[model samples]
Target: MNKAKKMLFSYSFLAPSIILTAVLGLYPIAWAMRYMFYDYKGYGQEKFIGFDNFRQIAEDGLFWDSVKTTFIYAGGKVLVSLPLALLLAVVLNRGLRGRNVLRAIYFMPTIISSAVMAVVFFTIFNSYNGILNQFLMKYHLISKSIDWLGPDHALFTVIIVAVWGAVGNYMLLFLAGLQNIPDDIYESASLDGAGKVQQFWYITIPMLGPVLQIIIMLAIINALKGYESIMVMTGGGPVGKTEVMYLYVYKLFFPTAADAGGAVQQIGYGSAVGFVTALIVGAVTMVYFFFSRRMSRTF
Candidate 1:
């Protein structure tokens, strides 16, 4: 083909993706940015009131509380999931029988839709009639069924579900990192009198540093953004106990019928909140990057 036709052909291939991204990704963000300075419901005439939406964010205690709850949820999920994922990666990386099947079983949860996974967990953790309750009751483990999804326990319950779904993904990443390490390094460590745990601590961990940094960063962002299971399982409450920032923003734009009339859609305010929430997540990622850079220097 001639140069012009070849160039045209390349541009043609890129055009569809560019158009889709502009429509699906860029347009919504631009729309939200425009509306953030306005006072509008989804159906109302928009009234521009610059910075008012942001000012309101400062005084919104509920949003702040949800931010705090989000930190807790994110922290708990990361703390539990990363170590377990690494451990699973280490174990499964070994030369063991049926390791492929085991890895597949562990990974199955990652393939499930978050909403569908949450629904399954809902059935299992249902306080009154759940299979968990039935099993515990039959064994006389407790005098009565514990409320797994109540206000006090709801956050914890969702974290467990989040970890269960997330660990598999991190494990697979860890497995890939592990496989890239040379077997010769382990053999040398073994000859030098290093035990399995010693090798893991002194060799595997140090070697996995770069990938670990990336994994932890990804895990933190995912945990902070995770709200699907919380929304599905609790709808952000028996008492708003499990309300993360994203879920809170979701309700602002799309309140459930159960919300008080005051909780109706405020598209402008929702946009502002969404912007702030994105900033919060972005700030966190930046902080992690900062620390990771310092740690990388030390190594």
Candidate 2:
């Protein structure tokens, strides 16, 4: 076959996906950008008010509060989930009894639907007659059941659930990184009389640096864009204590009147919120890449 024909065949295979992405992904972003400069309600007229949406977003206190909540939720998830995942990965990577079964058990949470898991957690955290409270009371930990989903505790509840659902996936990633390490490296370390703790700190961690960087970046992005669990569990409720950026954007374009109970959509404002959020996420990801250094050493 001619070189031209070979290149054409390879290019043709990617054409459909390229076109689909442009249409579905790029087009919407372009559309939103255009409308973000205007006052575009769910329907009817769209008034072009330059930078007003952006200004409104900046001046909005609730929006700022949501941003803070998002960071807290995201930070908490990374802090709790990643370390737990690393621990589980290290344990499971060992030649333990029923390793496969334990791995499946650990990973089961990731496969469960987030919405469904939120509902289950909601039931489990109910202040009155919930399993968690009941167990705590049984052990005499508290004289009364504490409200887990109330305003005071709502954010922590969401964070705990997010950590539980995320740990398995992160653990699997760590396991894959761990498996890539050569057995000879560890055998040599053992010959040098290196203790297990020394091996983990001096060898395993340094070797897993590249993978750790990827996991941290992903965890940050996922935490910032979080919506599903907060939606299903809290609905940004208990006076919006658990509200995050995406949930705030969702409420903006899809609000139901508090008392009159009519749909009130603000597409323009929602677009602005989303655009700002994208900017923040993009900046964070870029910063992570810029500052991250190589930790792996050549054996």
* Top-lDDT candidate index: 1
What is candidate 2's lDDT per residue for 1-299, written digit by digit as tens?
99999999998999999999999999999998888988988688899999999999889888889988998999999999999999999999999999999999999999999999999998899878788999999999999999999999999999999999999999999999999999999999999999999999999998998889889889989988988998988888788799898888888877867511246788998899889988988988888776774323331
Q: List residue ranges in candidate 1 displaced over 4 A.
A: 1-7, 260-263
Q: lDDT for each of the candidates?
A: 0.93, 0.89
Candidate 2 CA-lDDT value = 0.89
lDDT of 2 at 249: 85
Candidate 1 residue lDDT tens string, 171-227: 999999999999999999999999999998889998999999999999999999999
Off by over 4 Å in 2: 258-262, 294-299
Q: For residue 247, what is the lDDT in candidate 1?
A: 94
Clashing pairs in 1: none
Worst-scoring 10-residue span by lDDT in model 2: 290-299
